[model samples]
Target: MSTTTSETGARVVPIPPPLYYAAALVGGVLLDRVFPLAAAHPALRVAGLVIACAGAGSAAAGVLAVIRHRTTIVPHRPVATLITTGVYRVSRNPMYLGLALLVPGLGLLIGTWWPLVLLPLTLLAVTRLVIAPEERYLRQRFPDEYDAYRARVRRWL
Candidate 1:
């Protein structure tokens, strides 16, 4: 399924989260490769690895929650239920948050400043191009339940 603006008929980006993560990872790698920088301290590299692992864990938890709830994990697909437990209790967009966290973690691991610089831009793109549309759809579909959930949980933690 595709997302489109009713008023302008403009197409909303339907890029999947994995693709976004890949793009950000590739962009950061390329930037670092072209302009090599001093490697981060070993401690920092370890910290980055931990953060990346945490992100992957979080994303997995989110997916598991969705599965347990019998809902589609695909953002563009129809949501079967409003999930508010587990990771969803803390962050409305844990998967997106996970992907966002990976940027800095990977950057730090690679000892490149470029990924840190591009983090905000990557987040902005995900927020505007992906999360916003999903939020709109969820609000429309779940209405009251979603409103309550939104009130209780932060978008990202």
Candidate 2:
């Protein structure tokens, strides 16, 4: 999807990330269902809440940034603007970063330690599969401009 509104007449939709995010959440939920995490250890309840809240905050920041930019955050879709200001300055892929953070938060909240393993995997998937391809596309689409911006900013800060 080219960001040039003229190239793609239809409005861009937010592209969902890879299957692992959903898979991680579902697996976490299922594990919690079978074992029921916080029933025995009340202390974990507090920790879970904090982690989930942090995730929510990160996700909210990404969503707000997207809304402010008035474009899709998904890299596969064409980006109307580069959006180097604000949150974009900190992390090139905040939405994916936020969602990556969210998976562990969910696992933490559910008290399912096993599913938390997917946290690193989520980052790897986003970096290698999702973000890498999108970066290449962006570079091709916006060569010099994107390269200059990339030099200044980190991909996953």
Candidate 3:
């Protein structure tokens, strides 16, 4: 799916990252609730909470960087500038990475193994369905800058 913009032309990403996260969260919860796993140890739950908080922090930092640069946060919209600062410096797709982190973290928090098992599926979907297209758009839109950034930073860290 694609969305057209009169300004930047058309956007390749149809479903946004948030929606994907939401779906994964709901699916994981339902799976865990139905299947039921042994509850996670208290220590594990604490670790998961910490990890989830870190992921959320990373995502927020990325968004703040984009906002600071005054760029469009919407995936489909044309980017005003390439953000290479803050958490972005560490991961090319920090927001996506954060969302990816969230899955297993949430699973651990809920004391279920299902979400952890399903974590890779969410990453796969986001990588192929979302990040790939965004990378293509960035490459086309800001070839030199994006190429440099991509060469320097890992896709997810």
Candidate 4:
């Protein structure tokens, strides 16, 4: 069953957690470009590249998971098929996790330590405002099957 927005009757849109993470990442990038704090350190540059690569890798893995499941990765209305293999086995919200990873990577790339530190708060907000509710809905919608999957896998990995 599809979800709907109350007033508009539009399908309830689940905001992907990556959006916020990406926003933060972009912001961090801009800040770094404008501020240029990490440019002086060769080690920091290497670290930033590593972090950025890791973030890209995580996002790619999530995308592969979505394709493998043959499901829409939209946060609000997940596909009817329940995915339990590949990256889904590790994290119920790998896309979110990947985005989570991405923010800090961007921050590192930008040499903004504060933004990197803020990444956890961003994840917490997405989890509380979006992911948790989605989990509750999925629980109600799929019941036993979702519960089994939930039991076996972590919400974030």
Best by lDDT: 3
Task: Give TM-scores for every candidate, taking all chains together and pairing residue i with residue i.
Answer: 0.88, 0.74, 0.90, 0.76
Task: Give the per-residue Cα lDDT of candidate 3 at 126.
Answer: 79
Computed on alpha carbons, the lDDT of every model, listed in order, comes to 0.78, 0.66, 0.79, 0.69
- lDDT (tens digit, per residue) of candidate 4 on 1-157: 6543321211334565567786666666676667654533667667777877776776788788778767666656546566777777888877777777666666666567656756777877787877777777677666798899999998887
- Measured with C-alpha atoms, the lDDT of residue 153 in candidate 3 is 97
lDDT tens digits by residue: candidate 2, 52-153: 676667667877877888876555456676677776777777667667667766676666764576567666766666777777767766778879889988
Q: Give every collision pair in model 4.
A: none
Candidate 1: pairs in clash? none
Better of 3 and 4 by TM-score: 3
What does each candidate score in C-alpha RMSD? 4.1, 4.4, 3.1, 4.2
Worst 10 residues of 3 by lDDT: 3-12
lDDT of 3 by residue, 79-142 (tens): 8788888888899988877777777677778887677777777788878887888888888777
Ranking of all candidate structures by their lDDT, best first: 3, 1, 4, 2
Give lDDT tens digits, candidate 1, residues 1-157.
Answer: 6653222211248677667776777887897788875457998798789888888878888888988998777776777788999999899988878877777788779887677677777888888887888888877777798899999899998
Error of 3 at 92 (Å): 0.5
Per-residue lDDT, model 4, residue 97, is 75
